[model samples]
Target: MSKSGYFVSFEGIDGSGKSTQARLLADHLRAMGRDVVLTREPGGSPGAEDIRKLVLEGDTDRWSPETELLLFTAARRDHLERTVNPALAAGQVVICDRFADSTRLYQGLARADLRGLVDQLHDLVIGQDPDLTVLIDMDPKIGLSRALARGDGEDRFESFGGDMQRRLRQGFLELAREFSERFVTIDGNRPVEDVFADMRDVVGARLP
Candidate 1:
């Protein structure tokens, strides 16, 4: 809830329902007569969308952890420049499905150094952190199973195995601890309507 506008982010492991919650929040705001923009990381802007396909679907045999981090940040930079910044400048609430926090959790904890280059790059890419970040926390096994059941072949990253997904979940918790003021952990295993109700309460209290 900056003077400029709200930059709220939703974070969680795959199949944690972040996208669904983000859309629900945006729709709630719009119904209340507030202008809102709902977008996602790695594939928001056109340039970022192309990069996303390469990062998610392209060959990863040659891709190192650092390379993965760099690609995600590049997409974030483009997304911020093209979509997020413009929407916020126009005083619209920008609800992003994922942001730098995802990079911190995925690359930082699962792939790369949690204390090194990836964290530094995250700081650089997201100069000012999100006004609020709602983390839809859930069991990694459940989340991954849900993702697999949705019928998309495992991408390079998603195919990292169950242990990595568990680590990534811990990584998100670590981030929430560090940024307690901005991070809200929500139990995502509940029914969709119940989760939506909690999300509305959180957003309503913070949004102007």
Candidate 2:
């Protein structure tokens, strides 16, 4: 890593196992005696977690997409200020389960017109990108099945339905292409061990 902290984020459609991989990577790096800070958004910080409940819970129609975008951006700003930025300044490796890209795919590309707003908000408020983003690619059918099985009440985004999931998958893939230098697309349909091994390889090669 540089003088600053190394930032890595895991991304994928719901239940694609990016969260699991993020945890595993954090563990692996810690075993290697590296300083690591594992976090997630839009709830990594105290203020953000409160916002998380507002945005993630409630009826699917609780907030319009635009309102939801604003909530996410607000949470992200708090997360960056209270968690990510300080950790990076201290030179620790920060592994996050999701970041701005999730908002881009979920709220932005899900509707064509919203993309411009997402980009503008990102550039204006949340101006940083992860040094590395591990995109776990998987079939929407399988991913949705896994997500539904989790039974977590935080299913507002998941409630967007199958058509939305397919679009999310495509949106994430497009992001990998658009930011190829920072993205590593991993096949998430495989066994957990296989996925972790691939993630380990990518992360190891990039560690300072």
The estimated TM-scores of all candidates read: 0.93, 0.97
Give candidate 1's TM-score: 0.93
Please give the TM-score that candidate 2 achieves against the real structure: 0.97
Which candidate wins on TM-score?
2
lDDT of 2 by residue, 58-175 (tens): 7878998899899999999999999999999999999999999999988887844698899999999988899999999999999998897898888887887889899999999999
lDDT score for residue 159 of model 2: 84
Evaluated against the true structure, the overall lDDT of model 1 is 0.83
- Model 1 lDDT tens row, 1-208: 2447889999998888888999999888899999998998887999999888777764546477778788888989899888998888888899998898887777776776655777687666657678999999988999888876776543666677688879888889888999999999999999988998998898789887
- Report, for every candidate in turn, its global Cα lDDT versus the true structure: 0.83, 0.91
- Candidate 2 ranges with C-alpha deviation above 4 Å: 1-3
Q: RMSD, each candidate, Å?
A: 1.9, 1.5
